[model samples]
Target: MASALRRARAGEGPVLAWPLACGSTVAERTRAVDFAQGVLRVEVPDVGWRKELQSFAPQYLAVINRYVGESVKRIEFILAGQQLADRADKNGRSTRV
Candidate 1:
C-alpha cells in the first residue's frame, strides 16, 4: 500500500513519541493528532507554524521514529482548524476554508 494511504486513524506509539520527539517548544504549539498508517498527523496553530515545522519534517521524523522505531515515515503538519475541515469534508459537508 502507498504510504500516503491511511487504513487507520490513530497509533499509540507515535502519539506518545510526538511530544518528546518535537520537544517542549514545539509540543506547546502543535498537537499530535493521530497516526494514519505511517503518516503522523500533527495540528499546528496556523499556516506559519505548519510551514515552519513542515520544513523540519525529516529532523522531526528522526526523533519520532527513534521512539516509535521507524513506524512513522511521514509527518503531516496541518492547521488546527484543518483537522475539523477534513472531517467535515469526509462527511460530505462543504467547508469555506
Candidate 2:
C-alpha cells in the first residue's frame, strides 16, 4: 500500500521535491514529508532537533505554503518508527529478527 502511494507521488512534480530542496535542517533530519496528507511529519531524533523545528515552524510553513499553494497550518513532529528502523540499519543493526 505504501509503495503504491510512493510510486504515485513520485509522478507528481514539486509537491514532494520542493520540501526536500528547501526544507530546513530540522525538516531534512526528520522523515520525508507526506504531501498528499498536507503534513510535514518530522521524526524528532532528539529534543534538540524538535526544539529547532518548533522555533522555525513559521518560516518553514511559509516555504511549504509557497509550493503547496495552501498554508500548511500544522507541522507534526514525532518519533516515526520507520525512520528509527532505517537508522538502525544504517548503524549496522538488523531490523529483522
Candidate 3:
C-alpha cells in the first residue's frame, strides 16, 4: 500500500494517472504500483501507451515532483499482460488475461 503521507503530498492526477492508464483503479493503483526509493513502477496496458508515455516522461516527472514536493528519479513502465502471462506459464497456470 502507498503511504498516505505520500499520497497526500502527491496531487490527485499525478498520483492517479499512472496506474489508471495502466488499468488499475485509482485507489488500487496507488497501493499496487511499486513505489520505493524515489522510483515508481507501473504496469502499462500496451506498447502504444508505453511509447507515448515515454515521450511525455519528462513532463510527467515534473508534474509529479512539483506536486509531491519530492523528487522521483525514475518511472518504469512494464507490460502487464505479457508479464502476467509469463508468470502464469512459469507457475503452470493458464495464460489468461
Best by TM-score: 1
Candidates, ranked, lDDT:
1, 3, 2
For candidate 2, write residues 1-97 as lDDT tens digits.
2233244343242245335434555445665434435556656677776777778767766655554433356666656576667668889997878
Q: Give one digit per residue, the lDDT tens place, for model 1 in 13-58.
A: 7777777778899999899888877998999998898889988889
lDDT of each: 0.79, 0.55, 0.56
Per-model TM-score, in order, reads 0.80, 0.51, 0.53
Question: Clashing residue pairs in candidate 1, if any?
Answer: none
Instruction: Compare the candidates by lDDT and give the number of the best one.
Output: 1
Q: Candidate 2: which stretches are off by over 4 Å?
A: 1-28, 33-38, 80-97
Clashing pairs in 3: none
Segments of candidate 3 deviating more than 4 angstroms: 1-32, 82-97
Candidate with more favorable, higher TM-score: 1 or 3: 1
* Ranking according to TM-score, highest score first: 1, 3, 2
Question: What ranges in model 1 sit over 4 Å off?
Answer: 1-10, 95-97
